[model samples]
Target: MTDSTHGPRTLTVTEDFAGQRTDRVLAACFGDLSRSRIKNLIDEGRLRRNGEQLGNAAEPVRSGSILVLDIPAPAAAFPVGENITFPILFEDDDLIVLDKPAGLVVHPAPGNETGTLVNALIAHCGDSLVGIGGERRPGIVHRLDKDTSGLMVVAKTEMTHRALSEDFAARRIDRAYLALCWGVPSPTKGEYEGNIGRDKRDRKRMALVERGGKEALTRYTVLKAFRVYAALVECRLATGRTHQIRVHFSANTHPLIGDPLYLRRIPAIAKSCPTDARDVALDFPRQALHAARLGFIHPRTGEKLLFETSPPEDFLTLEKALGSD
Candidate 1:
């Protein structure tokens, strides 16, 4: 039998294994699964025999009895504290502001079960960091893409989480990003407004859609342009949506430099740049976008709070290479 990670699987007992225990037979059939795991699944009522749940892992298997094993989708593990480094800007009973790195995931998911910012926060804050609404993890009110580096605020208490979430929802939070895109926007200063939704053709990517997408607005100003090849721009979000910045730029034919999902091919604008500069931009390992500034009213202090960070070294290097400066 296969691992059946996708869904439930069934197998027939043969005369060669007529009298064996159910768990042992399952372990034998599912060579990739351990005997203990099969037993646990059986205990969890995940194993069925002849359309009835088999509550006993040690029950005898009859010849030709069909055993169906349901493999539940793997869940992210109970997060444990792990030491990871991030620049902490501020921390209090309400929240902690930190500069998240380009490669750090905000939390665990199916494939990323460890080495996340939440794991590090758990290690750093210990019992001080409570789970979000009773889930055993940090209160992440907002998130940057796994590869989009920069400022983020994590909540320490439930009250803070609720307050921060409300602010983000009401667009009371101020956020800005810097990105290197293939071409300069014609007006140099404008807003890209559209509804963003999952691309109909590609489930993994977001796109601007005429219907069924959330309204998104990205106000941008070109900070610098590299001949006709590319430009570094600052974008402020008026409405938050998945992949809002990348999708907006890409939709305008100004796809971000080194964006893996959006920049699908070599851009025509690259021909105008020196080969080295073009190479630097194209060879960049991740999307050339960074969260540069974040501001909001402190939930507890009521004093205005703001945090800013220079783009990571790779981003700056790409910018420099795109121009002589």
Candidate 2:
């Protein structure tokens, strides 16, 4: 049976299969669905032959049976922050800061226009959000990528938002990140200065450029290097540029493993690594990057504030897994 939402389709049961059990018939027609699931559907009266509910999974069905099926619509995803607990790291009359979790998108745009941090903020801040930086993004000072978890500041009023934006534009704020890379850098600790811009070949990606790009500065300190394939490193940004850490590291031949766009091909490192370390590198799911520390003067209060949030679970898990090796 087919309905409008399910689109136009016909479910045909062979006449030769008539007298077969309803579960058997459905299992045959639907490929690999479990018999128990078919039985449950039969029990729910969703499966009817000749417009009559088939109450029993064992009930015999005949050939040419007209089966009517109703496929229920899937429930919409309700975000957890709505009417649920949301951790607030810092809050005041002008702005609030949050330790945003990994996998949470910062704002709505195109395909991700809902179920974002902005959506939750809308619910939490209510009507207090004033447009920031001349956009609908209320009081948003800066952004971290969806997969990169860390501290973020949100403005509650236009005044504070403008102040923060001005500060960021002036390069007056300190932003530091923690990254788990595929291999240790040659220098262990050094500064990488380069220009970053959109890749000419792949518009969706960023690339380090010799010219015609924004100047980017990233300083690195080796936090912990394992005999394994990876190293825990801290990255401090002297200038804010898009994809600064990922791009500079990739250009320097030490891309973060599991980074979807700028993947590290470090088979040798993994192979050369000790047995325990190799196993950890193999299991991580995404590029291990985090905003571990951030310090800035309050746009409203003029007070110096320093905030730090530990890496999310995935980062810690990958760290431990690699450390175990």
Candidate 3:
């Protein structure tokens, strides 16, 4: 069969929405498109309220408001080019596991025009994604950061997706991450728990909070320690909160090395590096984090399944470079 990518489906609001902005009403009714995208489409004359063009993004709408929308299509196929690539670890009729690499975004968002894992999965899975998440995610059930390499399981059917989602929410699915951080904790292995919220002082970062934030828990055990500078640590998530590991470690004064937003200055432990190695270390970017292990019960078979993957070669090479003196 020929491969093709389809754009968003056009939508029209048929109900009344008195005194509500067109974009706001549309966003409330359809949770897929963001306010900005809605506004852009409206401004571009793509949206009409009751047969009238929606020029002002804030224009009020009355009851029986009729809204029209133009949705874009998905890409033709997953990456056949240099843009997107995700390592397929396991696949069956019901689900698939991917060893996602760092620098690959899980889904489409602002500033990421292409090369996302979703796009690649679309290319790879094709029609297999039809029953998963209504075409947006295809087979996607969970997500990993573009820079966080590890195994992610995707569901091919609505039943599988819902079942797996419930398992994640209940913490029945086991997620293990391997991270290289700047220092060793006083205890080799222990639990870290706190509420995580946006930092008031730095809006770009997350911080531990006493109130008004989601509760998060991360448990870590040291795998290997570098000379006073950093350690290879294993982290397990009891709850998956955004930036949970990074926030937890930074709060504990053990931020990940090469953390773009967390680490401030180079730690002294990295000084042991030879000149060539140090140069490469200086050029390395992104937090040295990897999701190495994932285990969960099969949605179809009801049997347990486990998956593991090593850190990317770049991560290992950087670690070696740091160790070289």
Best candidate, lDDT: 1
C-alpha-based local distance difference test score of model 1:
0.85
Q: Each candidate: what lDDT? A: 0.85, 0.73, 0.74
lDDT tens per residue, model 1, 91-179: 88778999999999988765788999888988888866746633444778898999999999999888889999999999999999999
Give the distance in Å from residue 72's predicted Cα in candidate 2 to where it truly belongs: 35
Q: Model 3, 177: alpha-carbon shift in Å? A: 0.8
Model 2 vs. true fold: TM:
0.71
Error of 3 at 298 (Å): 0.7
TM-score of every prediction relative to native: 0.77, 0.71, 0.72
TM-score-wise, the better of 1 and 2 is 1
Number of clashes recorded per candidate? 0, 7, 16
Point out where model 3 deviates above 4 Å. Answer: 1-83, 128-131, 201-204, 268-280
- The list of candidate 1 runs beyond 4 A from truth reads 1-74, 133-137
- Please report, as a residue range, the 10-residue window in candidate 3 with the lowest summed lDDT: 1-10
Deviation of model 2 at 29, angstroms = 62
Q: Give the backbone clash total of model 3.
A: 16
Tens-digit lDDT track of model 3 for 1-325: 1112223333444445678777887787667677977775654445655554445567677665556675655443333222366678888888888898788888655466467777776677676665476444566677887778888998877889989988998999988999988768769989899987666566457778774456899999998877666678999999987788999998888888778877777767557646676676667788889989999999989989999889999899988876775
